[model samples]
Target: MGGPSEEPELWAFLESLHCGDILSGTVTAIERFGVFVALDDGPAHSVFPGVGFISFAELSSRRFEAASDVVQVGRRVSCEFLQFDTWNLEARLSLKATQPDPFQLFVDAIAVGEKLPGQVTKLIPFGAFVQVADGVEGLVHLRELAWTPVETPSDVVQVGDEITVVVTEIDRERHRVALSRRQGSSAV
Candidate 1:
């Protein structure tokens, strides 16, 4: 029953659906209520979900303004169809609603007291967001950045520079990771 119209997005998805199909979409809009994603049915087709939702903070690992920066308008994202209403002509889309969080993996992926090398991605007032591994990073808080109180993270570590850190804590429940460098190398 798929036909070309102003709602090609919705129609394409209906045709592709098999009652439990997994789909991916791009963020179309972010409203006060929730985020809207244009379903990727193929060749840029989409579907609108009236009840779908995503938090703005979750859209980005941290800072977010432009949805494109986090969820591109045309980027395909993995999602599952929670439900679809024929009479209302709406669908429910979600990422967390379907997939397990990657951050949670860090809880088991990283081990406490183990040393992992990380790259300084950014320097902040608090510390640095080091990329310890592909998607794993732990904060080297200002207190942990040096043997003594340091004015800034740049003093010892700069962006793009690699540093070794010991896994201080891996909070699985909170999905928080704590890393330290003070224990690995002696300060001179």
Candidate 2:
């Protein structure tokens, strides 16, 4: 008689995984959508190199243009297991979940009306998104972009422009920080 197949053993190991468990792995591949990791203590994935995968947004607390900016192939990473992707047979992992949120730290250190140096990260018809701190971004509404009425965000600021902004409001529950460049100048 033949022994039990490895499939049952793999299933047993996968069944043992739970959300929030920390897993160590080596990054085996990086795609535009996410990174694939080879878990050190889990059954090897049949279709992928590793059993752990981190999506782009879960890769870092800070904004990065590419996954390679946060992790490289062969890099060892510690990630929190978010869920088991049954379809893919991979563990959905979060790299940022293991790190402290920079936005929360920024909120704890500052208050409304505080002026901070920020760089414009994105400009939209309604407003501009400013990076006030690492991974911390605030929105400067159209009306707040300048003292005078502006037609568009680009009139006051463009992507990569460095400017001063004042914290107009903070919604801790939502982790949203409203900022104003016009108010910043007045506060100075």
Clashes of each: 1, 0
Error of 1 at 11 (Å): 16
Best by lDDT: 2
lDDT against the true structure, per candidate, is 0.65, 0.88
lDDT of 2 by residue, 1-188 (tens): 11125456556676789999999999999987799999999678776778788999899978888899899999999999998676666789999999999989999999998999999999988999999988899999999988889899988788999999999999988889999999888632
**lDDT for 44 (candidate 1):** 39
lDDT of 2: 0.88
Off by over 4 Å in 2: 1-6
Model 1 poorest ten-residue lDDT run: 44-53
What's model 1's overall lDDT? Answer: 0.65
Candidate 1 lDDT by residue in tens digits, 4-102: 475566655555566456766666666665566665454433333422335554453443456555564445576666565454344555555454555
